[model samples]
Target: MSDEQDIQARAARGWRLWLVFLLLVLIGLAISGKMLTLNMQEQAFLKRQGDARILRTAVIPAHRGVISDRNGQPLSVSAPVSTVWMNPQEFDLQNASIDRLASLLGSDRAALLSKVSRFRAKQFLYLKRQMTPAQAVQIEALDIPGVYVDREYKRFYPAAEVATHLVGFTNVDGKGQEGVELAFDDWLQGVPGKKLVMRDLLGRTVKHIRELEPMSQGQDLQLSIDLRLQYLAYRELKAAVQAHKADSAAMVVLDAHTGEVLAMVNQPSYNPNDRSNLGAGMESLRNRAVTDTFEPGSTMKPLTVAAALMSGKYQLDSVIDTSPGYIRVKGKTIRDHRNYGELDIGRIITKSSNVGVTKLALSMHEDAVRNTMQNVGLGQVPGTGFPGEQAGVLPYHAKNRLVERATMSYGYGLAVTPLQLAQAYIPFATGGLTRPVSLLKLERPEPATRVMPEAIANQVLRMMETVTQQGGTGRRAAIEGYQVAGKTGTAHKVGSSGYEDDKYVAVFAGVAPVENPEIIAVVMVDNPKGQEYYGGEVAAPVFSRVVGGALRMLNVAPDNWKPATQVVMQ
Candidate 1:
């Protein structure tokens, strides 16, 4: 009985063990099948999830375009720089690395701590921007966790304050802020590129995967300014402003034939590279030659005489009686510097007689006076495309009041920018052709529109030539070997309470080598302090020095050059 029970028990145990072994094999096969499915079908899904943590799309900075003068001199440029950034979420502010970073960046430790704490949840934050590459290397050497450096570009003005008003400046983000930089921002800006990259836990790029898009560099710009002339004009104008203690000053020089702005400068200019004082005010930032306007004063006498000549009512030899030295029109008395008695049209211009020009305006229709000025570009924008350029105030009173007409004849009751005045004089220089003013270099001279007859323009130019001779108001504007043709102007500034007797703007506009004219320039000194505020005394000298140097620099043969006297050796 015991043997049968033992055999039965052993059989049951053996069967149980065989069942356990089979169950184990089934479990192993199920596990192997699940592994195969995951390896084959879900591999891409897993890889993508893993890449989300370490793979990044990074920006590749693009280079900004260059701005150069007419002769290929660089006025503005872009230099490579680095921006120090950090992942605030991963940054350890409590670590000693923060102190080292603050020291290297020249940042306040408290501010750095406060900024990091404030933006602790942010994935990215800028620590410092526009650092030199050398400086960035020192920061990178620290190898602080979460800290990174990005390549970028910083705008640099090579001309500094010399051409700052014209060339302008860019912001920290490489956007244009003022001047030509703002006017042509779209043309000067570049497109940043992107690339796929793999990074480590420290957020440093380990390897580049592929370029998403190629970076497009900005296009270069060529301006019409001649750097040589610009330097000369700047020097002379700055000297005049200092000598006269003027509130401000501006000067513009143009290639008479091409209408290209050879030199344009203003006083109280600031360096674009140094922005410490950028927020001071707009006075230093303004391009006054194009933006500011003033009453043109006696400089308009030549144009009035030109208008009279255009009417065929007055010739160079035509006479006007200026006896008593002053005339009252509509109860407003217009007086000359003195009694020149009777003066011909040419002598009237040479003497800058207010009464003489007023008589011419009274005799003719007001439309004739207004139309001639309009044709010559007065009270117009000058079409330079410069930012904030003013069209100036050219009022045409339909009433045609005698006082208004008389004042307008002598450059009163009207306003003009220095640029407009300079462009207006271009007609006289180019034989009555008024070309569009250009700030950019042109492959060829632009087409011109005739504003006055050639004969009339030449005759007016000849009449103006007497202004720079001895006894003329602009005698100080005379050059040694050049026939200078110009007029002097001094006008009381109109204020809240009418014209201010103490405030005056002195201006001189002229052309050089009158026979075969090359360049035309305008100089304006506003609110000159102390005595000697006349345009002939303050502004005319600047015109002479700047234009004389420019004429010689261009190698233009002087029309008034006399042969040196030869002495025979005894």
Candidate 2:
């Protein structure tokens, strides 16, 4: 009986051990199945979590357009530059590596720390902009947390001060500020693009995923400016301003047929490349040729003569006695330089006689005189679309007393820009057609307005030609190998106390190769202090050099080559 009971106990113990082993195996298989199911279901969620930390949308910068001269010489351009930035929230300012980064970037440790601290809650900040590539490399080598580098463009002016006022400049944000840059900002500015990029812990881009948008670069602008002529005009105008010790000066050169601005320059100019002077004042930044207006002085005499011809009241041979040399109207005296004696209407313009012009103005209806001035573009913008262009002052002729009308005849009581003065003489060169002045390149000459009858325009042009002849006001304006026609002006500079006794504004306007004119130039020298202040003496020489060089440059045929070459005794 004892043996049988022992066997039974042993069998039961064996069975219990086997049962426990089977239960363990079944639990292991159930856990394995659950693990497989969870792995398959959570794969996408895990991927999203990992990507949130490394994936980023990055900006792909676009480049600004280039500005070139008519000959395709570059005036303004953008060059690639590197900028150093940081993620303020991720940056560890207290790290030992922070000092190394500041030294490599040439930044102050305290300043960098303060800047980071100020924007600690923010994710992005610019530490340095427009850094050199070598400096950027040194910064990357430091490998500070959250430090980054980006490629950007900086505006560069190749022409510098040569085209400063016209080409203008851009700001830190690459927005146009002044000049052509400001005028065509919409066309010159670029559109930036975006892309998905994979970045590392240090904010460096490791891989590019896909481009979200394509970048569009700004279109290039080809202006009508001739760089060669621009340099020439700038040099001459600068020299004249210095030699004469004048306050300032301006010059404008136009294509006689197209009315395109070939060259425009001013004195006291500043470099567009260096903006330090901008803090001083904007006086040097002004394009005086277009922005500032001045009394045209005797340059208006040609317009007066043209109007007189248009009215049919005065023939080219019509004679008037200017023997007294002076006349009085409205308690004011209008005088001539000398007794011009009894002279033909043509001689009146050749001499630039104020008394003669006064007589003509008084004879015509006031409205006619006013209409002529207005028709010629006085008191109207030159339509160049330049910033700060002044339309000048033109009072109603009907309201003007006799004296005021007389002053308007000789280019007083009104104001005009150097550009307008240049534009006004276009009819003389274009046979009564007045073309709008253009700074942009035109494919073809546009149709012009008929400001005066063609016959009357030609007759007035003939009379103006004599002004460059012997015994005329603008003899110095005569160019070699060309038939020059122009008027001279020397007006007392108006001061706070009315016209000053010693100061004068010398001005000269004319068309060259008069037989078939091809160039029209206007020059104004303000407050010339030399012994000679007359327009012929002070301003005519500049007109001669510029217009003469321009004609030769264009290879225009000579109209009076023989006489022009001959030396005339002054």
Highest TM-score: which candidate? 1
Q: Per-residue lDDT of 308-388 in model 1, one digit per residue for the tens?
A: 998888777789999999998888888999999999999998999999999998888878788889998888887777899
TM-score of each: 0.95, 0.91
User: Residue 494 lDDT in model 1?
Assistant: 88
Tens-digit lDDT string for candidate 2 (46-122): 78988989998888989999999988999999988889998887787678878778777687789789889999999
For model 1, the stretches where C-alpha displacement exceeds 4 angstroms are 1-34
TM-score of 1: 0.95
Worst 10 residues of 2 by lDDT: 273-282
Stretches of candidate 2 above 4 Å error? 1-44, 95-100, 103-106, 563-570
The global Cα lDDT (0 to 1) of model 1 is 0.91
